[model samples]
Target: MSKRIWKYAFSSALVLITLSGCIEEKNLRPFILPELVNTPNYLVESFPGDSVLLIAAEGGILTRYADDRQYAFTVSNYPVLDQIDPTDVEVLYSGANETFWLRSDSLIITFSRERISNYRDTTAFYRPTRFYFDYCLSDDGVLHRIDYYNEIWDPQSGSFLSDYFLAIHRFEPSGSGLWESVETELSVRSDLLSSPNAVFKGDELLILTNPSYHVSSFRSGEVVAEEIPRESTFDQVVDPVWNTDDVIYGLPSEPAFFSPFDAIIELPLVAENSQRLRLESACSPSADVIGPVKVLKWTDQEAVVYVQYFTNQLTTANEVVGYIYTYGLKDGSCDINSVQSDPILLPFSNAIRDVALLNTELYIGTESGLLVYDFATLTMVPYLKNLFDEETR
Candidate 1:
């Protein structure tokens, strides 16, 4: 369908869906976590080929859900609190056999086969480098991290007190279940704004820089940056997802108001043609914001894009609430207004920090806990409750 026609169709469907009370109501339940205190962020990851999920919440809380059994690791049982507090978890990611969580101070926690190990790579976790902006894990389990740093110059001493750096570091696992810096994969000593987004297509690492409109690829100790064609300039690119193909789906810094709708951009890392896909909010008339795009799996014809939507936009104060939608994808593009499906509302009290999908259910991690939303029945449930009483392992 054409873009305009698709928008109008979605508008009509949205009106009907809204009027029919299709959007599920908020029925949030409490998570049974004992030591989850003063935490407002949570990240989630799903184990491949199994019905298992791992949730990492702020305040140094980690929980796993396998079928009907829920297991948690907190300060009481997990003695690693001396190394880092429960509130230190800033990012949570999963690899084939291991799950990694980054602390606020750059301390990393690696979980494998029910064992937890903590390590800090001083080479990459140097001073003045506060946090990791974006990252991706390769098939071989190496983590490529993009971080920003700045320094001040002192002219009287004829030396630089501080300087700015945009670096990409590779962290590989060691024999002791810890991680060490393999190398400083790519570091640029420039003042240009860097996008915290990176993806791996086979062996090449693709990265982006804002305003500069350049996508850099790193491989075999060589870094080559190609400027995105001017016709497809973006203010910002966040939450990039890469499939087997060369194209990546990323959310622009902000959603377009109305005209010339810009929701998701199809960046051709190596291809010549660039395409921008349209995703308008049917629930909100004022704004059409899309949070992040994650490709659960890709097939020969289509891929399932799990996206978070920020609806009910207002000028003075936005609602800060939204639902989950599955945009249709084919031929390396998305059909936001696909006739095959309608937008499903999975409301959470807080903004979505991270999401993981298992089968027909979505594991949504928020500040409170993990929400399990069933796509088949359009219902939601909260997990990680009563955590402190018992510690698993």
Candidate 2:
């Protein structure tokens, strides 16, 4: 080839490559990477037919279903708070007054309505190494927060403090400032395990310690622990639901509920007792099975229970598949009508942490984002990611 032709071809190639690079950069600039963090705790407050979904993880993301728009805000956005870590903020309650209560290691922050900018540090608690908190609203319009300290190991002191104490804090509106606080401590060493699930049933709090359950009276401070009956060999009791007359416990074979007088009443899932729901392997098997009950919601005639089943195959390295089962209860009998057998694969190592139901849709919460499944269309959509895309566009 001639020297002039070769030189012209070389210059044209360089220009084309540069233009392609510029186009690629411009296309990537609009995409915002999600902040990977722990799976968030989800709170759904329903009214009439709509609901307000709150995702508290790497900051707070609020979605109002009525409008189908979401607001993603971070605690660090408040410069006065000194760039508080968003993962440290745990949502406590979403009130009817359009306010939310959140807690960190050291402070309890309250956000007014849907405005993240309008917030205040309402109160403070002991900055423990690890903690879990749950709250219940009373009939008299008082909010009660139960603070459970799981671990209090101080590295500098080399001491394990906060052994087994639970705190109950009551909050009520007072004039124009923060809510009034009344703190009470309950010695719960005998009733709680190292890791226990705390649930509020009316004025009483129920603590489920895997195979056993405990009930604590807020009025009398009386604690009662009940063991599983010897006849029933259920693997675990989890995802307790509070009903008007009973407190239901999620079991493997049958659904059991404790009466007001502490009597155990179990409802059969199937007509034949031989075909019971078994969560464990009968013998030494090739694969390991793990079933964890996540949530339970009840109506007047039926109840819906959500459980996640995980299978870890020993043949492959890190090969795990997850299945989500939704069982419907009618006439004291249970049957599975919905199953999501996705392989538990999530972006940024996230897992399906929790699930909730609103109207005809199922809301699934993960470590990174939220997804919604419509029963009528049998389709699932990424709710949180779509909101981010819309905002950026």
RMSD (CA, Å), each prediction: 20.4, 15.4
Return the lDDT, model 2, position 344: 37
Worst 10 residues of 1 by lDDT: 337-346
Best by TM-score: 1
Please provide, for model 1 over 1-393, each residue's C-alpha lDDT reduced to its tens digit, 9 standing for 90 to 100. Answer: 699999999999999988999667786555444345224435565643445565655555554544444545665667664456444444445545546555546566666554677766555343555643666676565667766644444468655443444555666666654333333323433344444566665566655654222334554445565544444544345656665665676666522212123356566656434465554442132244353345443343454444444434221222323344445545334433110111232233324566667777766665555555656765455543313323342
Error of 2 at 9 (Å): 66
Which sections of candidate 1 miss by over 4 Å? Answer: 1-41, 47-52, 58-71, 81-95, 121-133, 147-167, 172-191, 210-231, 253-262, 271-275, 281-322, 331-356, 364-371, 381-393
lDDT digits (tens) for residues 1-393 of candidate 2:
699998999999999998888643334444333332123534332332235455554444443534544444553554433444554444434434544555554455555544653334445554551344545545343456555533334457654433445555566445654444333333334223333344564555554333333444445444443432333443333333444545343443222111111112232221111123332222111233234343344443444544443433222223322323333332334444343323333432125555566666666666555666656665555655544667777
For model 1, state the Cα shift of residue 169 in Å: 2.3
Q: Clashes in candidate 1: how many? A: 12
